[model samples]
Target: MVSSRERIKAFDKKLLKSGEYSVILSRLPAYIFELLLIVIATSGDKLSEMDVFIVMYAWGLTFYIAPYLNIWENRKNVSIYEVLKSLPVNQWDIFKVRVEYIAKLLLSRFLIMLGLQIPGFMMTGKILKENMINSLAAIGWAALVLTIYALPGISNYRSNKQIKWKAKQGGIMWKKM
Candidate 1:
């Protein structure tokens, strides 16, 4: 029997081949902008409250909007969930792989942002508390937004139903079965 890790790896490889990974490429600009925000938030000795607020707001907005854009662009194509459903893989394994992938991406960015603050702290002997707080808030906002967007579909999948999108009268309709 294939180990769970091996099964997830196989499913991930198939997902990659199915062009599901292209969503990352499509959101590259947003990712770069997010990185720049992290650098700006962490590089300074003293970040103004306004500066931190603006940066965090932009970061959160990017996190919220990028997923919508990706979904809109791919609305006509079969979704990764649909493709996975057609496979012989277990549903729980699919959920694990997806959640793990998202967690890794988010955690890596958060770690990089935290790491970037180290040099300034080392030189100044002071932590930029406001910037750090804002950064934490931004990441928390991102996780919340993603969770809100993901939970319904995940629950539906767990319940052995799928959401199908169909066009009717030039608009989209969601049919869950």
Candidate 2:
């Protein structure tokens, strides 16, 4: 039987292999489009706090669709969950590893988007303090909304050993890996 730690590592790798990289790469076009929108939106003028907020918000919202897209792209394929479910590991172990995979992906997206937004922020002609605060605030709100959206799944983990694969409301939609 594989150790839980090893199983967790395998699950993470499965997730990375399945479609995360491709999903992230596919987002490049969307990012470029949003950048163009921001440039056009603020053409010939310095950006207001609202403009900064809109850009940061769009940036945050763009990457937010990545994980879901990854999941959807691999929906017909056999998931790591399907593979691990018959193994010796406990169900919670599988569920926790899945959550970890999601959290890691979200964190990476947040960092990547934030880093990519710095240039846009600088272009706004705003003071560094204002840009930093607004960027942080916008990212923070996006993070909060993402967390709230995940809360139902997290709470479901408390009552159920295995993550739900059903599409019904209140059911966890994330497939393994």
Candidate 3:
């Protein structure tokens, strides 16, 4: 039997090998483009400092929301989660590790968004340093709100068994079977 420590390490390795990360990497450029478009469309001639900051914070928060939603909605796509579920490892441990992984991913995106904001702040004549606190606070609020939305989906996934999918004339749908 594998020890808990060994299982944890293996789970981490599985996550690394899963190749699902490419999804995030591939979408990154589109994210940047979309942000730029939003700025252009909304600002017209001038962009407000607070508006740009809100956009930056929102883009940062999307990092967390996207991954967690992917995990909860399509758990099977993440092979590490499957292995962890099958293993003797505590479910809570699996949950914690997944949460940590999500947080790490979020931070990476947050930093990238912060970097992009530099040019934006410069263009708007807003000092990034001066507005740093407010931007951070907005990021924090985004994280909190997204987390609140995620909890129910995770809990529902856990409490229910045999999640089922059905196809209709209109679209694909899922429900607890």
Candidate 4:
């Protein structure tokens, strides 16, 4: 059996070659804004409660907006799911790979945010408890938002037999006359 890591690497390569990474550019503003918020929250001698709240809100907003931005960006193109389906891999593996890809993407961002805190500590000579808590909360909220966004796709892949059945039937629908 092929390893999940190998599958993910293959998918990543394909996505990269197809210029799918460009879609991330659409989210550049959110990323920059989040980073700015982090800098603001961490650079001070004392943590501001208001700054922490703004950082939390910014994280939540960024996470919440990501799914919609992805959908909109890919609306005119073949989706990652469809690309995975076209591959020779099993349906279950396809689902796993997609979820793993998303997880890795989110994880990298989380790590970057955490790493950004280090500079703030160096500059300020102290780590703020509130900032740490804010980081944890942001990641928790991101995971929740991503999971909620992923549910519909997860449901579609949960039953391969159902999908096959619908595909075979051409998924016909009746419209009101």
Lowest summed lDDT across 10 adjacent residues in model 3 is found at 161-170
Judge candidate 4 at residue 42 and give its lDDT.
51
Give one clash count per candidate, in the order shown: 0, 0, 0, 0
lDDT of each: 0.54, 0.49, 0.50, 0.53
lDDT by residue (1-177, candidate 4, tens digit) is: 878658766756664546555646656766666666567555643434555655554455444334322332312322344445556656555445545655676676667666776778778777656566766666666566555544536433433334445445765332211
Question: Where in model 3 is the C-alpha error above 4 Å?
Answer: 1-6, 19-83, 145-177
| Alpha-carbon deviation at 7 in model 4, angstroms | 2.5
> 120, model 2: CA deviation in Å?
6.3
Candidate with maximal lDDT: 1
What global local distance difference test value does model 1 have?
0.54
Over the full model, what C-alpha lDDT does candidate 3 score relative to the true structure? 0.50
Clashing residue pairs in candidate 2, if any?
Answer: none
The predicted structure with the larger lDDT, 2 or 3, is 3
Worst 10 residues of 1 by lDDT: 64-73
lDDT for each residue of candidate 1 in 1-177, tens digit (9 for 90 to 100): 888757767755654556556656756766676756666656654444555555554445444333321232334433445445666766566556555555666676667766777776776677667557756666666565555444536444433322243354346565443
Count backbone clashes in candidate 4.
0
Clashing pairs in 4: none
Candidate scoring better on lDDT of 1 and 2 = 1
Cα lDDT tens digits for candidate 2, 1-177? 768867667755666567766666756754664565355333322224465655555445534443432243322323333445567767566555544545565466445545544665567654545544554554455555445433434333422333343434445475443
Model 3, 56-152: lDDT tens digits are 6555545433443334335322223443455567755655555565566556645655666667776776666644454455446555644543453
